[model samples]
Target: MISIRSVGKTYRSRHGEVVDALDDVSLDVREKEFVSIVGPSGCGKSTLLKIIAGLVPASGGEVTIRGRPVREPFPDVGFVFQNAVLLPWRTVLDNVMFSIEMLGLPGNDYRARARDLIELAGLAGFERKYPWELSGGMQQRVALCRALVHDPSVLLMDEPFGALDAMTREEMGLELLRIWEERPKTIFFVTHSIPEAILLADRVVVMTPRPGRLARVLDIALDRPRAVEMEFDPRFKAYSEEIRALIFRPRRERVH
Candidate 1:
């Protein structure tokens, strides 16, 4: 389980001005549950995910995973960023094994795991291909496999499919759902697409604009083993409209 309480982040800009990126955001995620955060650009969706991953520090409050406070990178979680960020020098198989090598784990023990993950990601034959040799979607699949090679209990994905084309993005989403169903990790996915979020997450977290705060957390009622066809469902459309309204709602006036 993951617990976030009153989390906030304030940073000083280059010009020496303070910027409030996130504020008063709190949430609880059950084991193996999938949650997605959505907000306007610059609302600190990425920041919040980083905080949960212990990649970034929170300015206030605390985030705890399974009763442990998060301060720095932990071993039980994996992060997939917007970019695949694969090394030009590494092949798909080698890239997937990179995590194991970096962690100083025995290569012999994890090579099988790496190959299994590569196969799971449908990159079996491309294991020897370099990042440039693969298309964008395949690269992201390699990145995802790399993140999961160590078998993390929690997965933090910051719009991993954001850079793909629409069709590729949906394909990747379906791939992610397949991976999650098979592995069942606690996942925190951050995305701009409401339909994608709804399709992938058990709960959708909506945020206010700047000085981001939790606007709402909607429990998606759509059935599990989700499909693109569900997007046409009335319930799916209703959830989309509700989240859209929350996101596009007028900002409350601030009285100085």
Candidate 2:
């Protein structure tokens, strides 16, 4: 489980102006729970994830995972960025094993796990292929495998599918759900797409613009193994409309 208490982040510009990225943000993600954060650009969604992952220090407040405060890069957390960020020179298998190498973990110990993850992502035969040979979606799948190779307890994903084509993005979403079902990890996914957030999360955490604050957290009551066709459900529409309204409404009128 994770807890973020009164967390805030500020940045100093080259001109010495102070910009607040996150303000008084507090949230909790239960064990093995999937939470999606959606907000406007510069709203600190990614910043919050970085804080949780301990990739960056919070300017104020604290983030703790399983009761321990996070102060530095968490060894038990995995990260997937907007880009695949694969080493082009490495083969698919090597890329997945890259994390193991960085962690100074024994390569032989994780080889089977890496191969299984590659297959789970539906890239079985392509393990020997290079990044340049794979499609955008396939490349991201490799990145996902790499993130999971170490079997981290929590996965911090920042728009892992944002760059793919629409069709591919949808496909990857389904793929991600399937993988999560088989190998569930506490996942905090940050995305800009409303529908994508709803489709993938058990709860959607809405955030405000710069000086980002938690606006609302809506529980998704949709059934499991949700398909794209389910987007037509009236409940889905209602959730989408509510979230859109929250994002577009003036801050003063917003209800948290």
For model 1, residues 1-256, the per-residue Cα lDDT tens digits are 9999999999888999999999988899999999999999999999999999998999999999999999998988999999999999988999988988888889999999889888988888898899999999999999999999999999999999999999999989999999999999999999999999998899999998989998889999999899999999999999999999888877864221
lDDT of 2: 0.94
What range of 10 consecutive residues in model 2 has the weakest lDDT sum? 247-256
User: Distance (Å) between predicted and true CA of 62, model 2?
Assistant: 0.4
TM-score of each: 0.97, 0.98
Provide the lDDT at 59 for model 2: 96
Q: Model 1: clashing residue pairs?
A: none
lDDT of each prediction vs. the true structure? 0.93, 0.94
lDDT of model 2, residue 16? 100
- After superposition, which runs of candidate 1 have C-alpha atoms over 4 Å from their true positions? 253-256
